[model samples]
Every structure is written in C-alpha cells, then in structure tokens.
Target: MAARAKREGVSPGELKGRLLAEGYAQRDHPGIVFRGPWHDRRAALAEGPDVWEVASRLRELDGPEEHRIAVLCEETALHPRHVRIAIDYAAEHLDEVLERIERNEEAAKRSRRAVQRRAALFAAVPDPGGRPRA
Candidate 1:
C-alpha cells in the first residue's frame, strides 16, 4: 500500500477509502485485506458482479431485462443459446461447474502431467522412470 500510494502520488488514506467504497476490504496494517484474481491473494476475486455489463447485454435479448434464464446467462457472460447447454452439462458435470476460467493454461498443463504420472504408476510395468513410456 505504501509503495502503491507512492507510485500513484497519493496518500494511503485516499486510496484505501476509495477501495473500501468500491467493495474492497479495509486494512489496519500495510498488508492486503482482500484477495483477487491477481497475484495478491488478499484482494477479492470478482465473480459475476458485472451487473452493468450483464444488464447492457441483456437489453439485446427478448423482451425486458428481467427475462429468466436469458438474463442469468447474459449476467454470467454466457450466451443465451448456451443456457440449455449449461443445463445439460450441469446435470452431467456439475462437480466442475465452479472452476474459474482465468486459471492459466499452465495450470491445466500441470494437472495433465500429474494425471500422466498417476497413470504411469498404475501401469507399474515400468520401462524408464523419468519420462513417458512408449
């Protein structure tokens, strides 16, 4: 915070107040009081608080902005036509529904490696230990 304030040429008090008003947490010490989608684990990660963007897009859907599934799909940045798709997938793959898409492709790479290692261990008829077997 001190570094940020200095860089922005503002006082910590001013910055903190604005952040608090914008739904960020307050801090007594100079550490993070919120978690986020970025490096700071303390800054709050924004989910679907994009009501303004959602409402704007919902205006393009049928009738009023309060339409049921269409409005909800729009609010979540999902296509209106994708609503039924989501419904079916939710029924099938509900366990993974809340996974955030912003997690980098690198993380998926890590998971793939882990799954491969587990499969190798299960195979047990080991050729070499370090890399994948043919």
Candidate 2:
C-alpha cells in the first residue's frame, strides 16, 4: 500500500484521506482497507503514524512491571507527550493493546529461538573461512 501510495505521488496519510473522502472504510488492521462502500464512515482518521509507533513500542516493552513513559520515549525517539496519548488510546482499546503485546511476545520468542539455533550451529562447527588447521 505504501508503495502504491508512493507511485501515486502521495503520502500514505494523503492516500487514506482521499479514500475516506471517496467513501472508503477501515477494516481490521492499523491502516485502512477497502472492504466495501463506506457505511457510517468516520469523519476523521483516528491516530497518526507517530501515535501508532509509540503504541507499538509500548506494547513491545510489556512485562511484569510497568515502565516509565520517558524511558519508552527515549527508546522510540518519541516525545514524552505521546506517551500520554498512547496510554489513553490503550485505555480505550484494551483488547487491541493486549493483541499488540501478544504479537510482540511471539516475535521476541521467534528471535530468541533463532539466536539459540545460530549459537548451537556455531558452537558445533568451526569457521570454515578461517586459516586452515596448522
């Protein structure tokens, strides 16, 4: 969709705006999708890209204890104010927040598994490109 937007000489946000103006409706996902003619379409788009990024980063940091928004802002290079926005947004959409957390956890698990596999392989085999046995 981004590529399409780029080719069309418009930012993704602009493309969405055009779609909304043309009666496009949002579907399951962060961005918009064309499912059918807009029905009771919203007058304006919800959150922007920055808010989405902040929310996603917050979700990735999910764990036993809550983290400071300042720390998250530092990690994501987002303004501290966006933290409040994300928190408010999450409060209103608990299910989506939970889904994001679950998705992030699954991704982390996959990454750890890949690292372990690579470590095992490297441990079992010496570097073939290194200086030949002397």
Candidate 3:
C-alpha cells in the first residue's frame, strides 16, 4: 500500500487525507507502515535540536578532582553554578563520587578492550618473512 502510494507521489498524510475525503474512518489505530526515512519521521524534529550552552564562571580549577569536575561539567552540559553546587553537595557523599568513578572505570575498560582487540588483530597478520605479497 505504501509503495503504491509513493509510486503515485503520495505520503501517509496524503493517503490519510484521501481516506478522510472519501468518508472512510477507522475506529482503531491501524498499524502504521513507515513510508519515508525513519530519522526523517522522528519526534526529535518536532522538538528541535537539544542544545544547552553552559558558560563556566570558574576560569581556574584546582586539583585533579576539581579538574575532572570542571571538564565533565562543561562536557555534560551542566551550567557552572549548577555543576559547582552539585560537586560541592556530592563532596560529602562518598557513595555518589564512587559511583561516578565506577562509571568512568567502566568506560575506560571498554575503550581498553577495543584497543586490545585492534592490537591483537594487527599482531595476527603475518610478516610473511619480509616478502612482499603480489
């Protein structure tokens, strides 16, 4: 049905409009068949791009902990004041900091795994005793 509609230069909305114009009505939701690109029909288009501009007031960050906080805060879209407050609040909460660290460790582990895999693949390729393969 969708292909036929498209070949005849029509979209789902156009087909739906024709049904309505012809006085055809469905009481239930008919299973929708996507006739266009999936991303093109996504809800994000209606909501627009998600962009949060965070300007950090703290120019200089002290210590490794403070440096990590500043970098992650800036990258994660948290405003300077909000990030500062959250970091300060989490400072006393050892559990939350540990949790964040655990997440970072997990990410590092994944990255290391990928690197090791690539290295192993490279190592598996034989040098062929320095003879060039034609």
Candidate 4:
C-alpha cells in the first residue's frame, strides 16, 4: 500500500481512502466509476454523463418522483436503473455533487464570456483585405 501510494503521489491514508471508496462503489454501484483528474474526481456512469448531471436534471424536473425518473430516463436514453444509481449516489454525496455542478456552471459562464469578448474583438478589427467594413 505504501509503495502504491508513493507511485500515485498521494499519502498512504489518502490512497487507502480512494481504494475503499472505489471498492464500496464497485460493490454497491455496479456501473458507476469515479473518474477525472485527482483535483476534480467525480462519479460517472460507465459510458455516460457524470452523476451530478443526472442529479441536476432530476432536480429541474417537476411531478411525482416516479414521473421525473421516467422523464429523465427518456430524455437521456439511460435505463431507470442507471438513473437511480446517480440519484442514490447524489443523495449520499450531496455536497460534493452539488459543488461539482456549481463549478461546471461557473466554468461554462467564463467560457461564454471569453467567446463573446473574442467575437467583439474580431468585429472591431479592420479587414486585412481591401474591402469596406460591413
């Protein structure tokens, strides 16, 4: 364990925590996996969106719990079982999942702002060719 931790660049305790968490998820959550860089690890379906995405969408939905689950499954093309896995994982790690969602939202906002600024800058630039500005 110590040697593996050294190879992973994390302390033994931290490595143990990761191993236990992964083990528990494997045993209980089947198709779920913790992924991403160490700084931004998140739970995700094997070949689908992160659990937080599903959870956030599930929050936006209205109606009975069963109805919401049905709608989400249809919209995402995920099985009900997969959706339930995300919901259950989100319930267990609410703060972590919500924080990731918020961080993603902030990153998206920053990206949009950068794109707008770039577009405005390009618009202000005079054309290199001998054509009049539109």
Candidate 5:
C-alpha cells in the first residue's frame, strides 16, 4: 500500500480505504490488498433490487442478452414486457453489464474461498482436494 500510495500520491490509509470500497482484499499479508478492475453498472440500469438480482444471476446463462433477460424475468417472477426498458438499456451498455457481472462472479468466488478457509481452520482439517494444501 505504501508503494501504491507513493505512486498515486495518496496516503496508505486512503489507498486501503479506496481499495476496500472497490472490492479489493488483502493478498500475501494482512494489510496488503490487491487492486483489480471493477465495473459498477447497476446504477446505470436504474432497475429495482429484484431486477438487479435477476440480472446478476443471468451471467451463467449462455445466450444473447435478450434471451438471458427473458429467462431472468421468468425466473424472477417479473413481467418480461415491464423490464424491456432495462433489457434494451443493458443491450446498449453490454460491455459494462458484462464487466459488472464478471466482477460480481469473481467476488462471489472469493467470498466462498474465504468461508471455506475459515471453516477449515476452525475444523482443523487439511485441504482434501487433489491439489496441494495451502
């Protein structure tokens, strides 16, 4: 953080806070955080929380945005026609939407890993996966 703060002309605390707000987590050491790209496209869509939740879950669907939106609306119990505006908006901002979804998925994976790590530590169980234990 000191190195990054020196490069960015900000204090280390400021850098750490900024990184934490941007979904970064510590790497190598407790205070050392890794910075990565984040796309916050939710504000651009102007949809309700339900719509956002549905849209986030659509990342795993392999198809065009329209098809994904249709499936998402059906699964979320939202009217498909009512969310057409959001779907059209998403189509226009496809790249940003995809980036946002990818970032969300990456964050979820990190969260799962953290939970598993904590559980393993609590249980005193070594990793049982084929890969070498950390």
Candidate 6:
C-alpha cells in the first residue's frame, strides 16, 4: 500500500481511503462507477450520466420526493434503482458531487461561449465565392 501510494503521490491513508471508497461504491452501488481523468474523477452511472446529473435533476424537480424520482426516471429512462443509487451517493458525498456539477456547468458555459465566438468569427469572414453574407 505504501509503495503504491508513493507511486501515486498520495499518502498511504489517502490511498487507503480511495480504495475503500472505490470498493464500497462497487459493492453497494454497482451501477455507479468512478470515471474521468485523475484530476476530475467523479461518480457516474455505468452507461449513463454522472451522479451529479441525477442529483441536479432531483433538485430541479418539484412535488413529492417520490414524484420527483419518478419524473427523473421517466425523463432519463433510468430505473428507480439506478436513480436511487446516484441520489444516495450524492447525499453521502454532497460536497464532492456538487463541485463536480459546478465544474461541468462552467465547462459547458465555456464551450458554448467558444462555439459562439467561432461562429461570430466565421460570419465576419468574407465568402470565398465573393458573395456577401446577408
């Protein structure tokens, strides 16, 4: 463990905690998987959205909890069990999950702005055929 931790550049205790968290997630939340680059590691459904997506949807929803879960399940086409797994995991790791969500949102906003800027630049360029853009 120490050698692995040294190689990973984390303390032995941090390594142990990571292993424990991964193991517990696998055992208790089979549908949930840790993914992304090391710096942006996050919990997500095996073949679906990140846990934060589920949690965020849950938060956006109104009405009773059960109703919100049902709506999320319907909207995402996920089973109740999968939705519950994400919700439960997010509850336990609220800070981490929320941070991930915030990061993703910021990334999405940046991407949208980049796309808009590129489009604007392209629109300003004269057509190769010498036709004016209307």
- Tell me how far candidate 3 lies from the true structure as C-alpha RMSD in angstroms: 14.9
Candidate 3 TM-score, C-alpha based: 0.34
Candidate 3 C-alpha lDDT tens digits along 14-127: 766755632321112112112224322211111211111111122234556567556856666554445544444334334634554556568889999999998887777667
Off by over 4 Å in 4: 129-134
Local distance difference test values of all predictions, in order: 0.45, 0.55, 0.44, 0.86, 0.56, 0.85
Q: Per-residue lDDT for 12-34 in model 4, tens only?
A: 99989987987797678778898
TM-score per prediction, in order, is 0.32, 0.45, 0.34, 0.83, 0.48, 0.75
lDDT of 2 by residue, 36-118 (tens): 22332221124333333456666567553246676785675655554665555556556755665667679899999999998
Q: Give the TM-score of candidate 6.
A: 0.75
The TM-score ranking, best first, is 4, 6, 5, 2, 3, 1
Candidate 3 stretches greater than 4 Å from native: 1-78, 126-134
Each candidate's root-mean-square deviation in Å? 13.2, 9.6, 14.9, 2.3, 13.4, 2.9
Query: How well is each residue in 1-134 modelled by candidate 5, as lDDT tens digits?
Result: 69878887778997778666434222211222222322221422223442234456666687987788788777766566645644554455477556667777799999999999997876665456744455
In TM-score terms, which candidate is top? 4
Task: Note the residue pairs that clash in candidate 4.
Answer: none
lDDT of 3 at 105: 64
Model 5 segments more than 4 A misplaced: 1-41, 44-47, 50-54, 62-70, 125-134
What is candidate 6's lDDT per residue for 1-134, written digit by digit as tens?
88988887888998789879888977887788988753567899887898998988888889998999999888979988888888888888899988878887899999999999998888887788887665
> CA lDDT of 103 in candidate 4?
87
Q: What is the alpha-carbon lDDT of model 2 when measured against the actual structure?
A: 0.55
> How accurate locally is residue 72 in candidate 4, as Cα lDDT from 0 to 100?
93
Give the number of the best model, judged by lDDT: 4
Ranking by lDDT: 4, 6, 5, 2, 1, 3
lDDT of 1 by residue, 7-101 (tens): 76668897677566444222321121333432222222133322222332333467753375666764576655444433333334333322322
The residue pairs that clash in candidate 2, if any, are: none
